[model samples]
Target: MDAAYVFAVRFRLDPDRGVAVEPETFETRLRRPADDPGESGWLFFRDNLWRGDLADAESFRGLTADALGVLVESVEYRALETDREYYDALREAIAADLAPFNADSVDEVVSKYLGSSVEIRR
Candidate 1:
């Protein structure tokens, strides 16, 4: 089955300041793990919403823990594999999760919060 994976890292706001800034703070590039390709989904989505099932939740958790070391505090694992009919459902799930942020739409939210743009890797 063709599948997709989304992984994210969240940071607590600097308490001294009232504003929140989400930056990619944990460094995994130094770790010499041949298999680890550090991909972050939090910054990719303007809303930082996730909707999917994990193929192997425990294994994913372990990989994330190993990559981030002490900084990773919690993780949510999901599994989802959908054909044509369920695509809208997945989108709805994403929207519902993002409602709390009062975003007019995902694109607007992502553009504002994603910070630096990424180069697409084919």
Candidate 2:
């Protein structure tokens, strides 16, 4: 069966705990399997997802994951619509973007859909 491209964005709502969600948050740290290549994109995604109110925190649809000794408020995921003909164009765009950093073609799927959100961890 053909695989799907899915973006899983991890967010920690309690800023008081001091989790740096800023751009380059993954830099300076050792590269791990769960590290984000670009926090800038995640920040952009989170901003667009915000609804002007965080009161519905519990109502937000997401899975739960522990991060920094605290539960990340939401671990949301979205699959891309890859069956469309436009997917070919999207793949080319993503391949160009990730070519500078990776040698594998597998990243084409992840980066194409998560380009504006986050990257698949190494």
Candidate 3:
């Protein structure tokens, strides 16, 4: 149940910055542990996502731009790829954590944040 939150980032660099810049697009992913559903600090999606997309594109773009030191043109969410085993555990964890989020159910929480972006891989 290996998992990651994938994104496609389009950015441009200024040649006048006095450095050779290559690649206009970058593919980045934040990996998640497959076995540790209750791991501390595992709220990546809950913190950064909303309604199947980024909670704040402008702020995310700013962060990405700052990280890369470039002008970010756009950011696209790809998917959260994982297996069934981990997904089930994630649901359980989400259920346990639902109180703080003021959510009714795990499915609601998942749908609110992930929507159709979750891909189950064998």
lDDT tens digits, residue span 1-122, model 2: 12233334344434567565554222111111221223233222222233222223454323233323434434344433233333454346446565543436735444433444333222
Global Cα lDDT for candidate 1: 0.38
CA shift of 111, model 3, Å:
0.7
Q: Runs in model 1 with CA error above 4 Å? A: 1-93
Worst 10 residues of 3 by lDDT: 26-35
Model 3 residue 11 lDDT?
76
RMSD of each predicted structure: 14.5, 14.5, 3.2
**Residue 37, model 2: Cα distance from true site in angstroms:** 18
Which of 1 and 3 is ahead in TM-score?
3
Best candidate according to lDDT: 3
Off-target runs (Cα >4 Å) in candidate 3 are 17-35
- The worst-scoring run of ten residues by lDDT in candidate 1 lies at 29-38
Candidate 1 lDDT by residue in tens digits, 1-122:
12232344442223345665566344222211111112243222322323333334455556666765544544543222233333343345446566654668655443344322322222
Candidate 3 lDDT for residue 85: 82
